[model samples]
Target: MPLTPIKSDDPVHLAMQGLFPDYNPACLEPAQDLELLRGMLRPRSSGGVKGLVHRSFQGVTRRCPRPLRELLLGLAHRLRCADPELLKEPNQCEFNRLVAGVRSQGSRQRGYAGKRAALCLSYDVDLLSCYRFLPTLLDQLDQRGLKATFHLLTDWEYRLDPALVEEVSARGHEVGLHGASHDVALGYRRDERIAGELRRALRGLGKNVHSYRAPALCMTERLMARVRDLGFRIDSSLPMSSMFHPSTQSCFPYPLEPSGVLWELPILLQDSTLFLDLGLSQEQAWSFVETHLKQVLELGGVGVINLHPSWAAKYSGFHGRLLDAAREWSDFAVMTHKEVYNCCRWGGAAPSAPAC
Candidate 1:
């Protein structure tokens, strides 16, 4: 639907126009309004009062009369009032926009030119079974000269040999939060459980990380908001498409709503899909991954491949072949998860509400 313009003389509309200046009032929604103002407040996910965007709002105090800045801030508060949960914690929105700006730059550089895939071999280390294959999997990635994000669990953070976890990080691979538990049925309890899990994993992973792939890919808007409140810039939980083959690959890194954090990439062909879902053999699974890669390349989009540590163990040779194919054929950046997240976050021009 096309955007409808607000009446020029209304107080709220006028304030928005003056604040944004360059953005068309017709193009703005309540969510977009919140995002733009939030973007003006903070760039990094970290909390505190020193954000440049936050200071810019403060500049209104110096450049304009006192009453005017007060009026604008008041209006911003009202505009951001739609979600009480969101209004309560304003920092998440600003941090999301900051990350979005970073991502837009990376996307521009990639330029929709050739097939550039970002295969995320995310290991949701929330299960004992998943961790059983860590040594071999790490060695495999190392042998192939590839790096990936290990979305580790808080429970195992201290339990895992510190040397092993450090090896992944020190080798220039990324480490992401995979929540603290591996419950597959979090959809019902997500609202209550998400914050605690996210914060736990964040503190466990050290404070510098920004990306998270939900445990079991079980995510919802409410869960995403919780992740955002915990200050994550990228959520790698884009839904996998049902289609396959070269022409059918249709995954790309787009922003998710409620949080506005850039979804680094989508999970297109998961390694376990064949075993757990389709019952494909080793040869069949390899064919599927290769075909999906070709389709992603042909479409000039990012190719996101997901593999579990447990699945890699179950299908040993398949793991080696898939990585080999990715290295040889795919033109995608092959990012360590953090690099992909930092690259796409909102920053340059204000991003409107993401396409639902």
Candidate 2:
């Protein structure tokens, strides 16, 4: 579908236009209005008195003593968000709006080989608990004759089991990399620091690990450039979920530079955000996933299902059902990140939409 032009010289409109290049405001059964949809897709930024306070608060927080920053603040969030029941106080109404936002944002295009929509089940193996749940996850995928990408942790709190990595790869799954701990600083650090950390992580895992996603989706151009130079074929660092407040980046795949050699694979609806950060109930979380995913499928775009192994094990009843449902989706192909990359790169996919 051709993008409907917003024929206006207004700077505001131009910025929004940039955000939604192939803009097609979907008119669903109930007829969601254009303005309503625009509101949903709008990129919010802080301004005025409140913006000043926000900046001040952030500055003060950053200036805090190292001990307080490392232990009292950063470490607290790291542990808390990983806990199943401990929430970061998310807004339920915002979540509902996000679910609704999917309905009106319209179809996205790129890199899929056929008319059938694409699905990629990606797991972030961050915790020891997440590592423990791998066997069961592998069995489920095997039973369903499906494959997924499992990104192992490196330079995190502990190391991932090399044996487990071999097992996953042997079963026709992808072994990707999650660079460091959930600290968001990986992106903003100096170039040499980031490069050194990445080199250390890729030392021996480089050959097998072709996909990389940053911890907590923390990324910058320098960071990604380093990743691409390090030999990662795909980077799933930008998260797509309206609940991410002002940054509701859609999870539509596109080629990253060095002229499309490396792909940008964005994931929508991460389990860590739902189960650990927001602490939504299993039913609520799964419902949100199913609703938005079906819409994306109908739009003929790739829907990346991101599950943290720790959370999946915590709510196996729901996660298991999700796996079973994948087989029933006769309309789509569930693939690993590497598989998607291959299809788009070599399997005659249409030219992808501009990078998100």
Candidate 3:
């Protein structure tokens, strides 16, 4: 929605050239070459060996012993991200590239007017255990004068249940669906099942929720279409994670076409890569996060961060540090997901690129 001023070595411009060399951002995915973006966003359906291997990978990540899982996570961190400092650069640039392409490619005429970049801090309350951690996280955001978006399960039987959604909403945070349950396979269910669950989840999400992020970011192309059909205006379910979903390598907000209405706000970097996978300490983890945010701002792109409530104790003061860090590097607006949706979906009291 807003393109930061670009420079000669701007990572955002370089990212577009590197990620989508022959792309036409103004036309919205017209060339078949965009298959790369589509393929990265949606994994291939299992047929034979591919299916078996996929399931095995899923099993290990889901049911492996804690020790082995951590071992695997550490190994991945070392192998792919040998230098943790650069772990998120490639992915962040992919997003910056999108911001650059949209700006330079003559897609949308309006750009973010502020000299500072945009930063969005978001949380996923994926577990009932996380319910206990919300108050502290909320307090931290409140103290920092910042706001965030929270995604919650619609069908959980927590004592608070829907009230949790209301509390977050009342606290000036944006609430969105994280599916009906925390089931990892929820995004892969049959089309009918997905639609039904979406309907049910919407019912439970009595708040003015118009966004949907699949639990664990498990998603398919058809499933995404269904999500849009169910009337979600935004989907922050994709990421360029090395350890988790091999989602898109970019992080700019773009519309899913031929119907360019529902926006896909890609998450920046896999924080889970360092924290959940690498098991890095807070100091090391925050270093990586700080660097990533700086790069995002320098490129004039929005940063959507996904921190889990379960990590509240482990990463205390992150919200405060985020605002502080953002200010040191660039001017910023720490908005919820919905605020971003409105920015990208409308322009100058009229429809712009990727607008409704």
TM-score of 1: 0.61
The Cα local distance difference test for each model comes to 0.53, 0.62, 0.61
Runs of candidate 1 with Cα error greater than 4 angstroms are 1-115, 156-158, 190-192, 242-250, 257-264, 346-356
In candidate 1, what are the lDDT values of residues 84-172, reduced to their tens digit? 23121111223223323333433222322233445656666655667777877888888888878787776532365667777778887
Clashing pairs in 2: none
Note the clash tally of each candidate.
Answer: 16, 0, 3
TM-score of each: 0.61, 0.68, 0.73
Sort by TM-score, best first: 3, 2, 1
Give lDDT tens digits, candidate 2, residues 1-356: 45445435332233232223443433122453435433423323323443354334445545555455546444445553233332211122232233334435552334354545778889988766677778988998999998899887765545655677788899999888886544455666668987887777766353446788876565566777788776677888765553432332444555554255677666766776666566678888788778767766755556788888877888987788788878788777888888787776656543332221
Error of 3 at 11 (Å): 21
Q: lDDT score of model 2? A: 0.62
Summed over model 2, clashes come to 0
Which parts of model 2 have CA positions greater than 4 angstroms off?
1-115, 180-182, 204-206, 245-248, 348-356
Please give the distance, in angstroms, between residue 262's alpha carbon in candidate 2 and its true position after superposition: 1.9
